[model samples]
Target: MAGGAAHRRPLAGALAALAALSACSLFVGVGALSPRMLLDEPDAVALMLASRLPRTLAVLLAGSGLAIAGLVMQTMARNRFVEPSTAGTMQGAALGILLVTILAPGASILAKAAAATATALATTSLFLAMIHRLPPTQPFLVPLFGLVYGGVIGAGVTYVAWQADLLQLIEIWLNGEFSGVLRGRYELLWLTAACVALTWWVADRLTIMSLGREASVGLGVDYAGMLRVGLVIVSGVSALTVVVVGAIPFVGLVVPALVSRLAGDNLRSTIPLVGLCGAMLVLVCDMAGRLLRYPYEIPVGTVLGVVGALAFLAILHAGPRHG
Candidate 1:
């Protein structure tokens, strides 16, 4: 009982801080709508509800989904340095998108999203299998290999785009952006919320799998089934995020990391907290982008890329004790 109380206190504090962050996210933007307008003007209300609201929601979903994806990847791979982006998953999807543009210029958005996601999942699975065969003495080798693989894919995409005279278009797809997100186009991001819920429902199995294949099998858990399901979830979240918001990089790596530090890594215990942390991190970055530019807009992806990189390096320097 006392232990529960001790845990609850810090947890409550973190939740409160997170809620405050969410509220701050609401007032962020360069538009004419002020806090007073949020309450006073109909036009302001419409703009707030239509543009900023959806954008905020999109940021939240992308951040939380990416963060959770990172958590799952780290736990499953038993490597703190590995993330979906670093593991060549997102890069593969980006390469897939470039291919689609070359081969099927008229492909529907749905078709492109599906193809990119399928390719990402397949590549991730292949990378993992290859990692399993590598010498165990070099534990970090696989993630490095994944990075090299992603770089190669990214280079290929860039080269193709240059040759095809679509470099500018490809550049837009390469970096993530949230400035253009509005009510209709941004709702697709809500799919990430659904993904988060699914993760919660399967939290127990994931927890079991995190202990390792031998331990999971000893406990009668179907390791292969659980793994395949997790991979699908990762691919869907990564691809959908890219499709909607253009590929915000480090949300996945940083959010889960911060949550794991504060709340511990138990699936059920840390899920919502991790999600909230992700939302807050992205929200803060998005707001910074909006406020710093005034009339002009900076992409949330760019801000996150800079911020997430710093945060990730900090985590790496902090070492694995917290994780």
Candidate 2:
């Protein structure tokens, strides 16, 4: 009971902090909003509903989805460092977006999202295949290989964008920001919520798969099928995030690492906490971006990159256990 209380305390604290940050996010913008204004001013109400509310929702959904995606990837790959951005999934999505832009200039948003999801899945599969080819003892090599593979994919996308005069569009996708997330604009991110729920439902299978193929098979688990499903979840979340708010790096990588440190690796128990921690991290970063320049804003992706890189380095320095 004491141990349970201890666990709930931190979860409660995180939730409280998230709620406070969310409230601040709703009120802290160029157009000031206050309790009084919400009741008295029509513009305040409209802005809150149309912009601030959507942005906050986007932050929560994107953060939670990416963090869950990271946990899934880490468990499946049995590597702590591997996540969507580092594993080329984001770049693949970018390539998909670029292809859609060039090939079907009039493509609908759903079509673009489908293309991105397909490409992300393909690239993630390639990364997994490469990992399978290498010795299992050198787990670090997987993330390193993913970094290089993603860079190659990114370079290809950049070259194509440059040639096609679509660099601006690609740039927007690369630098993730929620400033553009108004009501209709950010509805796609709700898909991430559904994905996260689906992931939660399969947490037990994922946990089993993380125990390695022999262990999974010993327990009568279909290791290959579970791996495929995990990959699909990661790819879908990554592609949706890229298509909706651009590539917000490091949330997946950093949030899961932090959550594991606080809550341990029991995915069934920790998935909710992982989602909350991820949402909190992104919310804090987004708030910081808004405050940094007042009227102007730094991209949330930029803030998270600097912060996530530092945290990632610290994790590396600590030499996380593979377990």
User: Per-residue CA lDDT of candidate 1, range 1-323, in tens?
Assistant: 12256456766776787677767766776667678886788989998888877887788788888888887877777666677888878877777777788899999777778877898898788777867776656655766787897788778878888898888776666688888888898776777788888888888888888888999999999999988888887888888877777877888888777777776667877777777777777778887887787767788888988998998889878876622
Clashes of each: 2, 0
Worst 10 residues of 1 by lDDT: 1-10
lDDT values for all models: 0.78, 0.89
Query: Which residue pairs show backbone clashes in model 2?
Result: none
Q: What lDDT tens digits, residue by residue, belong to model 2 across residues 1-323?
A: 12376577888888898889888889988888897899999998999999999999999999999999999988877888889999999999999999999999999888898999999999999888787787777767877888999999999999999999999998888879999999998888888888899888888888888888999999999999998889889999999899999999999998898888877777877888899999999999999999999889999999999999999889877875763
Candidate closest to the true structure, highest lDDT = 2
Question: Which ranges in model 1 have alpha carbons more than 4 Å from their true place?
Answer: 1-7, 321-323
What TM-score would you give candidate 2 relative to the actual structure?
0.97
